[model samples]
Target: MKRLSTLLLTASITASVMATGCIQPTGDAVSDAIPTAQDVRVNLPDSAGEAPAALGEVSEYYAMTRGITRGFNAGAGFVLVLVHAIVQMPPTTVDGNTYTWGPGSDPLDPADYRLTVIDNLDGTYDWSLDGKSKFDPNAEFLTAVSGLAVAGDEAHRGSGEFTLNFTNMKALDPIEHNDDGDGTITVIYDLENRDGTAASLEMHIDGTDENGQAVVADYAYAENQDGSGDFQFSLPADVDENGSALEDIILRSRWMADGSGRGDARISGGDAGDEVVEASQCWSTSFRTVYETSTHPEILPEAGDVSECAFADQDLPELPGV
Candidate 1:
């Protein structure tokens, strides 16, 4: 379903916003705590906290969601189309300022997704599927937008909202399940720096899955000079099968420009209330391979490894207009 795609798109936007050029801050408390680049040891909790054992599933859900929301081909409000994809189809028709896809083409096909972008001409533009297209048959979750940077910096930025309501949304990965129900996700993205500098990106998603379970998230990203950064993402008060409020779920990480980083995933307030279930290997430059530190062995038993640090070779998603 489009909901999964939208979720993945949000994740990609988050990574791109964080990877923008290094920006110098007048004074940032978060930067002060970062170990000097020469320090190889990452400071983290030696053991798990008081979070409940059930948090393992919550953390996995969030992790799987993040993984699902990465690496989409996009450009601001415009769906960046590859020249090859356009060439393989019949000639496109131009009417006024809009371009319509040829007949019998699947607009949702990554290669043939049909969309229309209307430039407002005042440093802003609107993007959406063609009204006549099947993607908008019922006129739901139709458009996205982009414009000035949220921070008034030289970096490009865009902000918009999307509503996803699909009964048959398919999960792009085996670990992910399309159990999400009708809902909306809002994203605010900052243009990445062409040069190293600080930038900001944020997102919020609130809705229920098919099972009617509440799905809520708050994500924030901040960068320091030298292209290093910090991030915090939380999913608060997810309900367990027994209907008790599980603890607030949180994932926090810090990284240096040279690929060294630290991270911890914690669940606070559930049956096992308040414990750290996942943590990274400090001083290690590896990406996303975390160790299970939770007292509850099954919180994330299937998570063979937990690595969140991005490798130097990892490319940021292409935010078309930016």
Candidate 2:
């Protein structure tokens, strides 16, 4: 079984030493069978000199809200993807006064931040598009990655050594905690450590963001704006100022529910007139997909059968050409 924790470190967090930074219960958490932070076992870094002394607060723990956890899982297990803008820097104000996160003149630390994942495989979750579901990061995905981890251990993370080990990381396959009506996945970046430790970074599979909410970002023909019509676009010359070859006409649309996980919006680009997406931005655009909930094999083929497949290596023609 994989360790429950993974990775997440943002630009601001990296500025410090750099510096650093789920889910619980089944459903609405009718059963208070959640795990407490104090009751959990974690590994703290060795007591150093300036690092430990700089910390004002030591250890902390908190509980996870389902909504927040769902956001985290939507990040597609990539911390960098979610940290879109720097937003307010660390030590940024909350209500009005400075919202002190942890230690240091800044808001994050790097030398001492570790995520301890407490994976409790209670029931089951399905992140599949069709209907197939499996066990994945377990409750920890939704629990620890959310509020509880920060509220509880935020102080310890920004500076001092904080270890988060979710020993119970076990689930069916890619199935995780939250369940959006659509097949979209959320890749959360709750952890922010420039040089610290990323115990669990592979939790997110991949997804899209409709304005803000994450969803199963997929591909469809594009002729117009509403995701219906034709599928052809034209570009201006000198599109490749950087000279990246820039041959492929890549397009992207974050299939995230708009308004912070409420509605769905397909921010796509085809032959449509909307040309806000310059060529440079399109380079990062994902053409196919990495992990797909829509294509999970009902029955995983035998190991030998998959190994023998030879045509998999050849660059098969794009779906368009076919």
What are the per-residue Cα lDDT tens digits for candidate 2 across 1-322?
Answer: 1112122223322233224331111222211222222212111111322332111222110001122233333333232121211212332212221122211112321122221222224321111111111222232222112222232233222111121111111121222322212222222222233344332221222332324344322122112222111111111222223433232232222211110001111111233224322211100011111111111122111112222211122121122322
Best by TM-score: 1
How does each model score on TM-score? 0.45, 0.17
Tens digit per residue, CA lDDT, model 1, 85-202: 2222322344453333322232243211333333343434343432122433443322222212122223112222333222222212212334546454444544343366555555
lDDT of 2: 0.21
Per-candidate local distance difference test = 0.37, 0.21
Judged by lDDT, which candidate is best? 1
Error at 34, model 2, angstroms: 12
